[model samples]
Each structure stands twice: as C-alpha cells, then as structure tokens.
Target: MLGTLHAWQAVERGHDVVQLEREPEARGASVRNFGLVWVGGRAPGVELRTALRARRLWERIGERVPALGFRANGSLTVARTEAELAVAAEAAEAAEAGTERGYRLLDAAETKKLNPALQGDFRGALWCERDAAVEPRTAQPALREELAKTGRYAWRPGREVCHLTGTGVVDDRGERHDGDLVLFCTGAWTGGLVRELAGEPPVRKVRLQMAQTEPLAEKLTTSVADGDSFRYYPAYRGEALDALEKSQPQTETARAHRMQLLLVQRLDGSLTIGDTHEYDEPFAFDVTEDPYDHLESVAGALLGHPLPRIRRRWAGVYAQTTDPGRIVHRARVAGNAWLVTGPGGRGMTCAPAIAEDTAEELDL
Candidate 1:
C-alpha cells in the first residue's frame, strides 16, 4: 500500500523507484494477513501519528483502489481471564496517558453492544475508536496495479534479490536493475539479505499460522480481539510486561509454547483467526494446513462462536527484531542500498506509515 500510495511522493521528489518482488503476484506476509490496520493494542507514545496518518492514507486509497476491507468501525479487545482483564485495564491507563490519540476503555456491556458476536465475560477492553482493517489479499494486487498505472514507478515481480548494491538490486540470475534509491522491502526474506548486505539490522524471521472459517451470512463488524492478543504486541506490555516476557521467553521452546489468538470477522462474514510463533533462522515457505491444535483450543475459548470448520490455513513469516519497532537502515555493505523489514505482526497496522518513513529516510 505504501509503495503504490507514496511512490508518487518519491517520484515527485525526483527519485526513481523500482519495486521488485520474487513472486509472480504480490504475495507474501504483507498480502496474507488479517488485513487489520490496527492501533488500539499498540501502546502510548509510539506510532500514534504514523498510524493515524496511515488511516488517512488508507481512506484515500479506498477512493481509488479496490475497496480495502477498510472498516473505520473501530476495534474491541476483551479479557476473560484475570490476567487478561488486568492487562486490559492497565493498557487503558497507559493509552490515556497519551491524550492525543483516540482510545478508551469499554466495559463488557459496552463492548458487547459494539460487537454482539464478541460474546465474552470480561472486565472490559481497550477500544481504539479510529482503528480499522482491510482484506489484504485483494488490497495488495490493487496496490500493485495502482503503482503500475503510474509510469513513474517500475514494478518487477518473480525477481529475487541476489545482493544489494549502492545503486540498485541485482537479482539471483545475475540481473542488475538500478534505481535512484533502493529499498529492500521483501518481508521475511530480509534476514539473509540484511546479513549479506552486512547491515545486520538485528532482524529475524518469525513464522505465524492463521486460518479462515466458512462465511457467516450476517455482518460482524468492529475488529474483535482480546487482551491475550495484546501480549504479542510489544506495545501494550506495561504492567503486563512481566507476563509478556515470562509468557514468551527468548527460546525455541518458548516460541512453540506461546501463541496468541487474534480473531477478526472479515467483511465477508468468514472469520480470520490465528496464530502461533516460531522463528526460523533461514526462513522457508513452510505452510501447515493444521496449526498446532492448542491454538484452536485457546481460540475456541476466547471467541463468541466455535470454529466449526476451517476453510483455509497457512503460515506467514515477517521480519522481527528487538532493536526497534522497524528498521530502514542504510546497508553497511552498500550505503546506497537500504534494508527495510522488522514489521513484526504490525505489518497491517504500520505498513503504510513505515513505507512513508522509508521515503522520508531516503529523502525520496
């Protein structure tokens, strides 16, 4: 969305941008998502303005591009367990600290009023009244076309990045394409590239599994989530910081042990739910139709509806790092080349703004 939305921004700045991806179509972690452009679970003093701006950009894109499942109807996060409830309350306190952003706590009754399908008993939830989501599978292709329509940008697909140069990207087949500014935007394929470029942006690949259920005929709006979901988002770990750290220690076993259920009812009425974490060093496109059974068990306990049947399931990997929320560093190997990754699960929430940040970082 960022490349297409702001390619003009760079073009207008006299920067020649060349967009490249290894897939035949726009497919990757960025495309396969819950398509939730979220900010509610994110903490205070981080990316509020950026997300707000991205919200604005998404709205504008909906005008010209395919209808992104962009629902400004807001989001609700419930808390069933005591641990979950406590975290929600603490998050509200923290969100309120950043008075400029649009967020508040909703009692269980109020939350149910917003999303009847979100039938759960809890203390309450942190509601980001301005947050929204889009159907990524559709939005990504629309974005590709949107960018291609503009002669200012050249987008090449089915191209693999062999290495990064000061000027542009050289594909695996010994093809070099130059651009005024080059941004390495591959999702999880970045770890090796960053290493090869020697920028060593302190990134790794985290794989998550998600599933889609059969469509429900009724409308289920208001992006529904839970406090346990907040545990995964590093932003909301305030007093729950201990729980977050202890819940998912830095270990392969911890990763296998930890999973967060983020269930959102898409516009089509089918629910998109997921996910568990496992970071693999050299990432592979390892997809599993059946995710660990316990993820579904936890999800079943959290949701208003039981997952009767799963229509689709797949694994997605995105760049993650402890260094920062995101990275747009100049390659240590080649200053002209840049490494852009580490979106974590916030790709849908933060991609547009991060893309804008990419342009800003390069003065594109």
Candidate 2:
C-alpha cells in the first residue's frame, strides 16, 4: 500500500516511479489485515487528521479501481457493560475533538436498527458512520493495475533489494535500478539491506493470529467489535475507560495474550475475525488454538448464535515503533533513499496519507 500510494502520488505529479517487490506479489501484513479504514479509533490530532484524509483518498481511489471493493458500511463497537457504554458516551460527546467522524451513541434498539444481525444482549454501541472497508485480498493488485494504466509506474516483482547504492538499489540478481529518489516501504522486513542501511530505526515486530469463517446466510450490515477493543485502541482512553479497566479487567488469559475481538465481514459474506498481539521477539513458530476458541465464545455470545465453521487460519507479523506515541518511523537511509515503515495496525488505514506526507516533505 505504501509503495502503491507513493507511486500513485508521483505518477499523478507526472513523475515516473518504479516499485520493486521481493515476492511474486505482496504476501505480508498488507494483505493479511482486515482492510478497515477506521476513523473513530484514532487518537485525536495528527493521527485523526491523517486517517480522515486517507479515508477521503480511499474513496477517490476506489472510484477509479472498482475491484478494490470499497464499502462505506460503517462500524459498531458493541458495549455489553455499563462502563463500556459510558466510554461510548464520552466518545460521542468528544467526536468534534478530532474530525467529523459521525459518532453516535446508539442504544440497543437503535443499534439493532443499524445492524439487524446483531440481535444479542448488548446495552448499546458506539457507531462511527465514517468507518469503511476494502477487500484486503485484492486491494493491492487493484491499486497496482490502476497505477499501471498511468504509464509512468512500473512494478518489478521477484526482485529482492540486496544493497542500497545511495541513489538506487542493487537487487539479488546484481541488477541496479537507479532513481533520483528511492523510498523503501518494506513492511515488517527489517533485516538484510535494511539493517545494513538503517540499523533498526526504533521499530519492533508484532505477531498476530487471525481466522476466517465460512460465508453466513445473512449480512452483518456493519463491521463489529467487542468492548475489549477499548483496551487496545487509544481513542477510548480516559476516565471512563480507566474506570472500566479497574472494574472489569480482562481475563487472565486475555491479558496474558493481549487479545481483542474485531470482526469484519468480507465481500464474500464470510467473517474475518481475530486477534491476539504478541510483541516479544522470537515469536512462537506456531499459532495456538486457545485464542481462536476464546474468540468464538465471545463472538457467539454477541451474535446469540453459533459462528459458521472456520475455514482458514493464519498468523502474520508487522512492524511497529517502540515509541508508543509515534505513528511511523520515517528516516533517511542515504542522500537519495528514505525508509517509511512501522505504522503498526494503522498501515491499512493511513497508508495513503502517510505516503502523501512523504511526497510533500521530499517534494517528490
């Protein structure tokens, strides 16, 4: 997404851009995410601004690339407890502190009206009408195809950059690709040439496990999240959240694994659910089924029905900054080369705006 955004921005400005990929196609964090353009969950300042800008950019780009499967279905963070409902109330009142996120505190009846499928026991939900989604499995390819039509963009797959040459890169094949300005948006991969050039720019890797279920017979209407998400996202932090934390601490297993339940329906009507965050290095080689089991229990409770049979499960890793407050770690690797990475889970939501910031700053 970063590469495609940069290439799209440069090509729109009438500059030629080339993107090099190490694999036949992107098969990393970019593709393995929920493809959520979440707005209400962002912290109130530059992060929110970037997310709002990116949200607009996504709609514009989606218009050009219909295959991206952009949908303005919005989101519902269901609040099962009174404390959770209090946090939602606070968020609804403070919506103007950031962008116009269209936040509304929905009672159980109204929540059901917005999403009829959520016919379960819940006090209310925090509705963010600006939240949206895309098809993660196909978004990159769709963007690349659209960029190819610009005639000023080139994509070189199966080219692993083995070394940096100041104004260009040398691939493993010993071929040199030169450019006036080079941007390395290398996702979670911080080894090899990146290590030799940047030497770990305050970024850490995070591993998560996620799964997809078989298609449901009904529509979810909007993306859904359990109240446990309040602990993971910054937007819900404050007195209400702190009180909730004190009163309703996460389960021992959930806290140990840093678990959160975010559920989003895919274009095919299947649900993509996850995940547990593991920040420690030397991540386990295998994913555990305990987290999946816990997720099913929580999701079933909210839906008041059994989930469809699980069809697939996988684990992924992405880079995040060691600094909790930083959005991404952008650094200059050479006179003409720059590295932009470590947007954490915000990568899918803020890539376009992040790339736009890069282009504007470097005058690309």
Candidate 3:
C-alpha cells in the first residue's frame, strides 16, 4: 500500500512512473489488514496529524476510485464495563475530542441506536466519527486503473529489485530501469537489497493473526471495537485507563497473545475481524485457535449471538519503527534514492500523507 500510494502521488504530480512489484499481487499486511482508516487510536502530535491528512486524501481519492469502497461510517469502541466506560468518558472529555477527534460518549441505548448490530451487553461506547474504512483487498488495483488512464503509469509485477543504481534500480531480470529518483517502499522484507543498502534500520517486524467471517445477513451499520481496544490504543492512556487495567484484567489467552478486537464490515456483507499482536521475531509459522476462540467469544457476547462462520484465517507481518515518536523510518540510501518503510499498522491510514511528504521532501 505504501508503495502503491507513493506511485499514486508521483503520478498525480505529473511524473511518469514505473512500479515494480515483488509479487504478482500484493500479499502482505497491506492486503491482510482490517481495512480501517482508523484515526481514533493514533497517538497525539505527528501521528494524529498524518492520519487526519490521510483521511482527507482517502476521501478525495475515493471519489475518483469508487472501487476503493471508502466510507465515512465511523466506528464505535464498545465499553462493556464501568471501568471501560470511564476511560471512554475521559477521551470524550478531552479538549480536542470534539473538534479534532470527533469523539462522543454514548450510552448503551445511544450506542445501539447508532449500530443496531451491537445488540449485546455494554454500558456505553466511545464514538470516533473521524474513523473510516476502505476495501483493502482491492484498493491497489482500483488506484492503478485510475492511474493507467493518465497514460503515464506502468506497473510491472513479479519483479524484485536486485540493486539500486545512482539513476534508478536494477530488477532481478537484470533490466536497468533508469529514472531521476528511486524510492524504495519496502515493507517487512528487510533482507537482501534493503540490508545491503541500509544495514539494520531502527525498525522491527511485528506479526499478527486475523480472520474474516462469512457474509452477515444484517447490515453492520458501522465498524466496531471491543473495550479491550482501550488497552491497546495510546489515545486512551490516562488515569482512568490505569484504573481500568487494575480492575479489569484481560483473560489469560488475551494477555498471552496481546489481543484486541477490531471488526470492520466488508462491502460483500462479510465482516473482517482480528487481531493478536506478536512482537518477538521468528513469529509462529502457524495460527493458533486460542486467540480466535477468545475473539469469537467476545464478539458473540457483544452481538448477543454467535458470529458467522469464519471463512478465512491468516497471519501477517509489518514493520514498525522502534522509535515511539517517528511515524516511519525514511532515510536517504543514496544520492538519488531513499528507503521508506515501517509505518506499522499506520500504513493504510497514513499512506497518502506519507507519500505526499516524501514527494515534497525529494521535490518529486
């Protein structure tokens, strides 16, 4: 997604572009995520600002590419306990809550009124109206189709860049593709050329497990999140959260996997849900049923019924900068080449803005 968005930005700037893809199709976290344009959980400062700008960019780009499936349906982070509700209140009461984050604290009744699909128990919810969604699985093809209409975009899939030239890059085919500038938007693939050029960056790979369910019969009016999300997002960090943590401990399974439930409905009526964080390297080669079982239990309790049969299950790895403050690890690898990676989960939410910044920085 980062690479595709960078291509989109370059093409928009009237520069002819040739995008080389390692795989015939993207099969990374870019396609495997929840497809959330999640603005609610971002940390304050640069991260939040980048998310806001990307939201605007997504909205504008969605207008031109309907297949992106962008929607402003917003999200509801359900509070199942009084402790969770207190945390929600704190976030909603923050000074920038209304203007910047579009936060609202809603009672159980109001929460159901907004998203009737959440028919189960909950005290109240934290509503973030700035949050949105898009069709992650198809976004790249849609964007590329639009870029192709400009007659300046060339997409070459199944091509791995083997070497970087001062002018451009050399593909595995030994074909020298020359250009004025080269931007390497490598995701989690940090070995080979990446290591040769910029040895061991200040970024680490994070693995996660996720799944999608069969088509839901009823409309999921908005995206959804479990109160456990409060424990994960930086936005909810406060004394209230501390109390909640002390009072309501996570289940052993959840704590072991570092789990959180983020549910988004796909255009096909299927619900996309996930996920569990795995930070240590050499992540499990297989998925575990314990985390999925926990997720299903919570989701069932929230909806007052069982979730649809899970039709798909998978795991993905994304690069996250070790620095808590930086959005990504972008640096000059050569006189005319740059390496941009490690936006973490923020890649989808902040790609457009990130690419725009790179364009401006390199004067592309």
Candidate 4:
C-alpha cells in the first residue's frame, strides 16, 4: 500500500514512478488485515489527524477506483459491561471536545436500530461515523490498474530486491532498475537488503491470526467491535478507561495473547473477524484454535446468534516500530534510497498520509 500510494502521488506530480514488488502481487500484511480505515481509536492528536486525512484520501481514491470497494459504513464498538459503557461515554465526551471524530454514545436500543444484525445484550456502543473500509484483497490491484492508466506508472512484480544501487536497486533477477529515487515499502520481510542498508532497525515483527465466515443471512450495516478494543486503542485512555481497567480486566487468554475483536462485514456479506497480537519472535507457525474460539464466542454473544461456518483461517506477520511514538520507521538508507515501513496495524488505515509525509520530506 505504501509503495502504491507513493507511486500514485509521484504520478500525480507528473513524475514517472516504477513500483517493484517482491511477489507477483502484494501478499503480506497489506492484504492480511481487516481492510479497516479505523479512525476512532487513533491517539487524540497527530495520529488522529493523520488518520482523518487518510480517511479522506481513501474516499477520494476509492471514487477513482470503483473496484476498491470503499464503504463509508462507519463503526460501532459495542460495550457489554458497565465498565465498558463508562469508557464509551468518556470517549464520546472526548470526541466532542476534540476534532470532528463523529463519535456518539449510542444506547442499546439505538445500537440495535443502527445495526439490526446485532441482536444480543449490550449496554451501548461508541459510534464513529468517520470509520470506513476497503476490500484489501482487491485494493492494490485496483489502484495499480488505475495508476497504470496515467501512463507514468510501471509495476514490476516478482522482483526481490537484493542490493541497493547508487541510483536505484538491483533485484534478485540480476536486473538493475534505475530511478532518481527508491523507496522500500517492504511490509514484514525486514531482513537481507533492509538490514544490510538500515542496520538492525528499531522494529519488531508481530504475528496475528484471523478468520472469515460464510456469507451471513443479514447485513451488518456497520463494522463491529467488542469492548476488548478499548484496551488496545490509545484514544480510549482516560479516567473512565482507567477505572474500567482496574474494575474489569481482560480474560487470562485474551491478555496473554493480546486479543481484540474487530469484525467487519465484507461486500459479499461474509464477516471478516480477528485477531490476537503476538509480539514475540519465533512466532508459532501454526495458528491456534483458542483465539478463534474466543473471538467466535465474543462475536456470537454480540450478534445473539451463532456465527456462520468459518470459511477460512490464517495467520500473518507485520513489522512494528519498537518506538511507539513513531508511526513508521522512515529513514534514508542511502543518498537517494529510502525505507519506509513499520506502521503496524495502522498500515491500511494510514498508508496514504504516511506516503504523503514521506513525499513531502523527500520533496518527491
């Protein structure tokens, strides 16, 4: 996504851009995510602003590329406990006090009214009308196709960059693609070329497991989230959240695995759900059923019905900066070569803004 955004921005500026992909297509964290352009959970200031800008960029880009499947469906973080409800209320107040986050604390009735698919017991929900989604499975291909039409963009796939040339990079194919500048948006594969140029980057890899269910009988009008999300997002921090944390802590397994329930309905009516965060290296190659079971139970309780049969299950890994303060680890690898990565789960949410920042900094 970063590479695509950079290329798009460069092309828009009347500059020729070449995007080289290690795989035939992007098959990394960019595609493995829930495709959520989540805005409500971002940190209160700079992060939130970046997210909002990216949200608008996504909508604009989606308009140009219909196949992106962008939807301004909004989101609801359902609270099932009193503590959770307090946190939601506080978040609503915070949203009102801050920027136009479009946050509203919805009662249980209102929550159900907005999303009829949610039929279970819940105190209320935090409604963020600015939240949206895109079809990650097709977003890149769609964007690349649109960029190609500009006549200034070129995509070279199946080229694993192995060495950095003074001007550009040399791929494993032993071909050197020359360009005035080079940006490495390598998602999770941070070794080899990246390490050689950047030197033991201050980034850590994170692993997660996710699954998708068969098409549902009814529509989930908006994306859905469980109270567990409050613990994971920074925006929910405050007196109320602190109180909730002290009164009602996460379950043992959830805390151990860093679990959160982020559910979004696909354009095909199927529900995409996940996920558990694993920060430690030597990540288990095998996907465990425990996290999936927990997610299923939580989602089922909120929906007031059993989830449709899960159609697919998988695990993925992405790089995250060890320094939480930095959104991404953007550094000049060489005089004209740059490496921009480590947006973590925010990759899909803030790719455009990140690339924009990169472009501005490099005067691209």
Candidate 5:
C-alpha cells in the first residue's frame, strides 16, 4: 500500500511517474485482499503506530476519494480457549500499559455487547478502536483515477519492466521508459525485479487465499480473528514482542498445512474471510482455486457457527520476508537510480501514509 501510495504521491509532486505491471490486465494480490486498513494488532508498538499512520492517511484520502470504503469500526480479536484467553489478557494489559498500539481487553459480556455476532465462548476479546478497513476493488481504482487526473503520471498496467538502467526502465516488450525516478509495486513478483537491480535481499513469494460469504442481511462492521489466527503469525501470540525486547526480529512463516483461518466482515454485509499461506520461493508464484477449500474449512472453525454461504473465492500473492516487518525499502542502486518495494501483506494498511512520506522525500 505504501509503495503504491508513494508512487502516486511522486506523481502529484510534479514528477513523471509510470507504474508497470505484468498482467495483461491489472488484477491480483494487490486488489484481491481484505481491503483492511487495520490498526488493531499489538497495541501502541511500532506496528500499531505505523498502522495508525496508514489508518489516518486513509481517512485523509477518504475525504475526497469516497469510493475508498475506509471504515473506522475498530477490531475485535476473540479468545476461544483458556490458553488463548491468557494470551489475550497479556496483550490487553500491554495495550493498557501503553505499548504504543492501544489494544483494550474487553470481557466476554463487553465483547458480545458491541458485536452480537460473536457466538462462541470466550474469556475476553482484544479491542483496537483505531483499526479500519477499505474495499480495495473500489479504493485502488479511485487511486488510479486520481493518479490519472494528476496528468504527470502514466499507468502502463499491461507492461512489465524487465530491468532498470539509471533513469531508464526496460519492459518485457523490449520498450523502455526513462524518467527522473522509477518505483516498483509488483508485489509478489518483486524478487525478479530485485535481481534486475543491485543488492539482492532474501525474498519469498507468498500466496494467500481469501473468500467472501453470502451477505447475512445484518452485518457486523468490525473485523475478527482468533487463536487459530494467532498461530498464523507469531506476533499475535506476543512472541514477536518478546523477541523484539531481546533485540531479535520476529519472523514467522504461516504453516500452509495447518489451515490457519482469520475472518473479517466487510461493509456490504458479506463476510470476508481467509487465508493460509504457501511460500513459493526463488522463482515461483501460483494462485489456485484448490486452496479455497482449505481456507473455508478454517473459517468454519474460527467462526464457531456455520457461515451463511460462500459467494466468492480467490487466491492472491504478496512478498514475504524472514523479518516479518513489511518489505518496504528505497535505496540507490547506481548513481541516482532509486528502487523501492517489499510490502509483504500489510501494504494496503501502510500504503497511504507511505505514499505521503514518499511524496515528501526530496530528490537528492
């Protein structure tokens, strides 16, 4: 989200910006996401602060780009088992103590008070009042439309860049685009783009699959995740926090075989739920409908009650790093050539603020 936002910001600031993509049409990972501009995780920490920045940026953009369905409904994380509740208690205490990302622990009565959709037993829930979500299908197009209006940018969606030479970029078509700067937002395909540039960092192409259930007529606006959700990433379990306290970077790979499921409800009354990750490293990126069943099965478990009906299913990919922090980097390759990428999965949440900051970065 940040890199794309930055690319557009660069365009707004009088720099000629050209965005390149590989698909004959622009669709996948970037658009096929929960559209969640969330700030509910590990409260008051760097992650929360960054999410808050992105969350606020979305708010600012929503002022004009109304299509960007940015909703500040907050986030609710439920604890099903006693062990999970204990962990939730720790997180809530940390949040209350002012960890930087403010997460409050609400008891079961309080949890159900706000969201009656919660059906199962839970000791308490983690409430992040600042988290928000946006439907990317609408938001991304609005952004592109706004970028188009700037007139300083050209969105070469069908063309994929083969490499870059100083201010010139060579596309797969054998054509080239030279400008004052070039930014990469290719998501999972960034490793190939990285090889074309200098200083190759460790990269993995991660595939995440998601689905939407039939609208329940009455919808819950907030997002939800559980113990199974905690296992999907180490940070939700506080291991990330503990590791960071010891000068260690917490890194986690979503166990593909475990069928970890996390669920969130969208504004249109449909249930947006998903995702198990498969890491196809060093020359692999695949999205298949076969994995849809895996995700649906987990969603069924996490929801505790039967999902009304599944209306759509799709697979998307993003770049993943050993250090779970987003893969966002901007460095000079040769002379004044600049390169930026590695958003991993949180791009949508972080992009708007990132773009604002990128817009402010003066050309040296």
Candidate 6:
C-alpha cells in the first residue's frame, strides 16, 4: 500500500511512475490487514493528523475507484466491564472526542440500537464516527486500474531489483530501469538491498495471527472491537485505563499472545478477525491454535453465539520502527534514493497521507 500510494501521489502530480514488484501479486501485511481507516485510536499530533488526512484521501480515492469498497461505517469499541466502560467514558469525554475524532459515549441500549448484530452483554461502547474501512485484497488493483487510465503508470510484476545504480535500479533480469529518483517502500522484508543501502533504521518486525470466517447470515453494520483494544492503542492511555488494567487483567491466553479482538465484516459478509502481536524475533514458522481458540471464545462472547466456522487462518509480519517519536523510518539511502518503511500496523490506515508527505518532502 505504501508503494502503491506513492505511485498514486506521483501520478497525481503528473509524474510518470514505473512500479516493480517481485511477486506476481501483493501477498504481504498490506493485504493481510483489517483494511481499517482507524482514526479514533491514533495518538495526538502528527499521527492523528496524518490519519485524519489519510481518511479524507481514502474517501476521495474510493470515490474515483468504486472497487476499493470504501465505507464510512464507523466503529464501536464495546466495553464489557465497568472498568472498561470507565475507560471508554474517559476517552469520550476528552476535549477532542467530538471535534477531532467524532467520539460518542453510547450506553448499552444505544450500542445495541446502532449495531443490532452485537446482541451480547456489554455495558456500553465508544463510537468513533470518523473510522472507516476498505477492501484491502482488491484496493491496489483497483487503484492501479484507475491510475492506468492516465497513461502515466506502468506496473512491472515478477521483477526484483538486484542493484541500485546512479540513474535508477537494475532488476534481476539484468534490465536497468533508468529514472531520476527512487523510493524503496519495502515493508517487512528489510534485508538485502535495504541493509546494503542503510544499515539498520531502528525498526523491528512484528508477527500476528488472523483469520476469516464463513459469511454471517446477518450484517455487521460497523467494525467492532473488544474493550481489550483499549490497551493496544495510544489514544486510550489514561488513568482510567490504568485502573482497568489493574482491575481486569487480561486472561493468560490474551496476555501470552498480546491479543486483541478487532473484527471487521468484509463486503462478502464474512468477518475478518484477529490478532495476537509477537514482537520477538525468529518468529515461529507455524501458526498456533491457542490464539485462534482465544479469538473464537472472545468473538463468540461478543456475538452472543459462536462465530461462523473459521474458513482460513494465516500469519503476517510487518516492520515497525522502534522509535516511538516517528511514524515511520524514512531516510535518504542515496543521493537519488530514499527508504520509507516501518509504519507497522498503521500502514493501511495512513499510507495515503504518508505517501503525500513523501511527495511534498521530495517536491514531487
């Protein structure tokens, strides 16, 4: 998405773009994500501002490409316990809740009224009207098709750039693509050329487990999140959250896997649910069942019934910058080349704005 968005930005600026992909198609964290334009959970300042801009850009781009499946359906983070409710209340009461994030504190009745499919026991929820969703699986192709209409974009798949030349990059096929500037938007695959160009950039890779279930009989009006999500996002950090954490510690399974329940209903009606974060390196080669079991139990509790049988399961790794102060690790690798990567989970949510920023910095 980062790379594609950069191409979008460049093409929008009347610059011709040639995008090279080593794989036949995208099969990375960019696709293996919740496709959430999540605005409510971003930290204040640059991160929040970037997300808000990306949200607007996504809506506009979606308008141009209908297949992106962009929908401003919003999201509800359900609070099951009183402590959790207190945390939600605190966030809803924040000064920027309404003005910036469109946050509303909804009681259990209001919550159920908004999303009837959440027919489970929960005290209340924090509603963020600014949140949105898109179809990650098809977003790139749809965007590429739209870009191609301009006759300024070229997508070369199944080609790997093996060397960086003064003009541009040389592919594995010994074909040298000449250009004035180069942007390496490598996601988690940071070895090889990235290391040779710039030695480590204070970034780490994160592994997560996620799954998709068979289509549900009913509609999930909006994206949903469990109260445990409070602990994962920066916007929820407060005294109330501190108390909630102390009072209602995560279950052993959740704590072990750093799990959180974020459920987004796909356009096809299937629920895409995840995920457990693993920060340690040398990640396991196989996905574990315990995390799936935990996800099923939590999802069932929220739905008031068992989730549709899980149709598929997979794990993905994404690069995250170790530096908390920066959104991504962007550095000039060479005079004509720059490496922008490590947006972590925010890649899908903020790619458009990030790419826009890159274009501005480079005066594209």
lDDT (tens digit, per residue) of candidate 2 on 38-151 = 987988888888999999999998998999999999999999999999989988888473348889999999999999888889899999989999999999889889988878
Every model's TM-score: 0.82, 0.97, 0.99, 0.98, 0.82, 0.99
**Model 1 vs. true fold: TM:** 0.82
Higher-lDDT candidate of 4 and 6: 6
lDDT of each: 0.65, 0.89, 0.94, 0.91, 0.65, 0.94
> Is candidate 1 or 6 superior in lDDT?
6
Local lDDT at 171 for model 4? 91
Please say which candidate is ahead in TM-score: 4 or 6.
6
Error of 3 at 254 (Å): 0.6
Off by over 4 Å in 6: none
Q: Scored by Cα lDDT, where does model 6 land?
A: 0.94
Model 5, 4-123: lDDT tens digits are: 576667765677777766775557677788887766553245655666777777898887777777778777777655566666667667634344445787888888877777756667
Candidate 6 C-alpha lDDT tens digits along 1-364: 9999999999999999999987889899999999999999999889999999999999999999999999999999999999999999999999888999999999999998999999888899999999999999999999999999999999998888899999999998999888889999989988889899999878999999999999998899989999989999999999999999899999999999999999999999999999999999899999999999998998888889999999999999999988998888899999999999999989999999999999999999
State the weakest 10-residue window (summed lDDT) of model 3: 215-224
TM-score of 2: 0.97
**Residue runs of model 3 more than 4 Å from their true location after superposition:** none
Per-residue lDDT over 44-129 for candidate 4, one digit per residue giving the tens place of the 0 to 100 score: 77888899999999999999999999999999999999999999999999734335789999999999999999999999999999
User: How many residue pairs clash in all the candidates, one count each?
Assistant: 0, 0, 0, 0, 13, 0
lDDT for position 80 in model 1:
64
Best by lDDT: 6
lDDT for model 5 comes to 0.65
